[model samples]
Target: MSLEENATNRHGSPAHIQLPEQLSSKFIDRFIRLKTTYWNREYAIVLLAIIGVSITSQQFNTYIKYIDFMNQPNKTENFHLYGCLSYNLFGYMIGLIPGGVLATFYPAHNILGICVAISSIGHVIVIMSISYLNSLTLCILQMCIGTTMAVGDLSIDRVWTYWVPLNKQSIRHVPMVMYLVIFEEGYLRDTMDKLHNEHSSYSLTLFIGVIGLAWYVLWLYVINGNYSFGSLNRDFILFGGLNNSRYSFEAYGNSLTRSIVSDIPWKSIWTSKPFLAIVVLYVCDSRLYQSYYYNTDLFSNDVFEWTMRDNTVVLLLLVVVLVELFPEIALPISTTNVRKIWSCSYFGSLGIIFFLEVILGNTIKNNKMCQYLFKEMRHLYNFGFYVNTLDIAPKYASLLSSFLMCIHYYISDILWASVVRPILSFA
Candidate 1:
């Protein structure tokens, strides 16, 4: 007999039992959004996993920057540093195509899990290599790390394509971008008195690796993504004994989308105007972003002779990072509006870059203002073209994004070698 029936048979009625039961069910339904049929709770999990991977993957960069390798006990020449950087970039470029192809053929979450685990183990090996200061070993490990970085990047893109709903894309990306504001990159330097030893750094890397492995486990079991165990069906159990079987990538994909393998219109996609436009936009977008991120520190030091510890320099960096959050707050509800904002902001940034170089490049205060404006202008991209790859070609977004990245990096490397290097040397 049902609990209500038994209670009623024993007592006069089951009013007390039913009230608590109803309240518990209401609480659970509110917690899981069971009343809302459209929004899946797994989306939040995917975002968290992506954030975890992004933060953990930066260990190499963190170590390289904080170590001040050129002045260290194992002192190396600048040429070696340059070579390491070049090799790392090359590794990422070489892996892009293969990584995209692999993600396309397999389930994205599965590939993501494997890549994160590999990257985690790689962290240990990389730390060991650093102790020896063996250039060859370090270079090879950096290359491997770069390759995993590419694959991990593509996997996350594919997962986002498969998991996040269309209309919710802009708002969902906000958290990841906002994460940068709170995660102060200079915290390592600020806390150097505490984590002062190489061994401490090594231990931290290992701890992060463990966290990354936990992320892998979460993806392996919790997330029901594009393809689950060779089938295109969603079958997963959530907490509170609720079985969630209502969502799948196929159901969420574009209406005209067909079987993944047989339906890819590669020739059309390659030659189409929209795709070509997207490539042009992405190349320019990536170039601007890379230029700022990689060289902004150098620019400040060379032009203004300001160290990172300077009050002005620290404030500038804080302002630049804070500006990244503007788009997330200002983003509109519709994709069309988002696209308009992106176009305006992108062109406006290019104009600011030109104006800064030609007109206002003299004063330190002007430079700081210009840097803040430039960063603020670029982020409409987070809402627009960043997500539009999936919008245009849901099935082929990963492959296409990879191809665009390859092209952009090739162009960037060439420009850096021939144009940027010579100009900076002359200046």
Candidate 2:
């Protein structure tokens, strides 16, 4: 059957009909080809964003090392480290609502470009602050950097929805790809310690800054030259033609224009049992996860006397295993089932790991077997939770993501600052 006929039958025709000959065969061919292409224009955006996220992740994961670098002559206390980290989380909270609003109205690429540029500036500030031994300046810059990362992260869902057609099989893999990117950054930070020591912090900051600036320029070019808001304009040629109903495009475009709070079904969303459940799950998960993540080095040192390198190597291996293995195990199941299973399993495993660490504190010291097992379980759980987010509430994907992330960061930050840091200070 002709593409037009297939679309008409699938979406139902409008009152008016156009001839098949009027359809662009070339466009259709391009779209068909893009369906299979693993690294198309949409994927290019994903990749650039991944790089941006990885840079931020690397900074965060290596904050302890950064702190050591900053305290070249005088040794700072643990409170200083926790305080700097808390500021980043505070910035994450500050960014969410504004990021969501910006993403809803402006093009996602615009938000991304601005956020990336700001983050690059923050990196520069961080390097300078460290050199000058400006503690307050460093804290403020860290917060600003965190906010920029949050904005970029919150806006990413919009890019996926608009740029990648729903029909493509490759779309399903985007979440997994993102997970791998995040974990890879941690791995790189750990493994590249020698390289980082060889070079100055200025070199690292400059490298990340150059990448962000380059991505911003590329984003502007692609969004303006190739794509249009709310319609299949000139750039539809890249995706092959839009075969779906015009209403889909219209709705997407209209969504951007509507007021963020007024346009959304806030009452329905808040009342939604599934949505509420997911929010609760995320809050609990984030609290535990962030606490563990922020204090990973301390936890390893205190519990097992493992160095940062050891912790990072284990984390990297876990990420690799998850990236390679989980999809084969979980993708065959229903998306909802996969989400539930993964989340529950992850939480359970974390709980078990924590229990063991606490209960067998002295006996299991430097126990590589226990550490490896815990790492694998943690990665598996992460794989599941991320993929689940992509599948759940796709229509309200961006808004839902922003809401969940905002709450998650807020709760996690609170726990880290109020509960975790105080205890660490005393210890």
Candidate 3:
């Protein structure tokens, strides 16, 4: 009936396809060990990113806290005024393009280092601006900071996509929360409540952040993260190749770029549904994050009776994002199921916030009472996004969420900025 049986009947006896139990187990065991090792190494590198960002995230939190505690008009105006720096938003729009280009043409550490070094310059400037405290200077510095942050971020994402296993990528977000939790002061409503009077916390945090980043440069070197083993630049820069010129390396990158750029047809992108969805997702998710960042002050206003440190602490952000994502990622069975669960949670989070707002408006007359009500509600909703992230696959899951979020995020931001900020704000 089968080819093997026919061959055996026509010729001699069938060939034995025997695998020993010990050999099979040993082989499987070795494979499992190798996979674990590969995962650990990549994870360790990402953990270092968490460590490096901890200082910066904390500094950003300190800024949010300072604005809240001081309750300054200048501090409130900073968010709206900073919006004039369209450079920050523009950075997000085009951020992923260069990374895509580099991944297509080259795979190495030089690109990574270049991205980090440029971003570090942004951090350095922010720290410097804080020490100086001129409003105009701060706004300009914020614009520069946004540019470098986008550049560095897009570059890091490119590397993650290329090297990390698609299945395990969702777990990557757990460490992503570390900066929010440990460094950003997400869960410190109690501690921060007691320390609100101390103005030095903001200045001291920035000073420490600058010193901390100085060590990230060393961490990069320790990891041997130089893009290429023999960096693309070294061959032309130090070893002297293709003409013994300083700009020789430029030719290599340029030629590679030209070849890649020429191959890509611009028209095909619009026709691709998956690509469109991804862009939508990134736009939406980033918008929510930006809105959230902009609102800490309004929410923290004692007039509104919400404390940013207590309400939106970095740990809360980290926990809400991570706790839910971990189990879903670990037990993924089907994409369809993941999508269903994701939609449920996404909508659920939105619903909870809406319900909380309505309840706060109706039941709580006293500002103090409203604060307690909203604070509990905030914690509950934060858990929703965490569940949403973990249930979906990162490559597609994050992109999908970003796309859907983008639609509502834009509508909300425009409405909030144009209509709500002026008319509806309590303060």
List where candidate 2 sits over 4 angstroms from the true fold. 1-37, 56-70, 74-86, 125-142, 165-171, 174-185, 221-258, 290-332, 351-370, 412-427
lDDT of 1: 0.59
Per-residue lDDT of candidate 1, residues 141-176 (tens digit): 778877888887776666666666454344455544
Sort by TM-score, top down from the best: 1, 2, 3
Candidate 2: tens digits of C-alpha lDDT, residues 136-255: 767787888888888887777666655654432332554445456445434465554765688775566456566666655556555554565444355332322332332132445555
What are the models' TM-scores? 0.64, 0.64, 0.51
Clash totals for all candidate models: 0, 3, 15
Q: Which of the predicted structures, 1 or 3, would earn the higher TM-score when compared with the native?
A: 1
Cα deviation at 71, candidate 2, in Å, is: 3.4
How accurate locally is residue 294 in candidate 3, as Cα lDDT from 0 to 100? 54
User: lDDT by residue for model 3 over 170-228, one digit each (tens)?
Assistant: 33444443334443334444344356565475565455456555645554543554544
Tell me how far the alpha carbon of residue 360 in candidate 1 is from the true structure, in angstroms, after superposition.
Answer: 4.7
Best-to-worst order by lDDT is: 2, 1, 3
Candidate 1: which pairs clash?
none
Q: How close to the true structure is residue 43 of candidate 3, measured as C-alpha lDDT?
A: 62
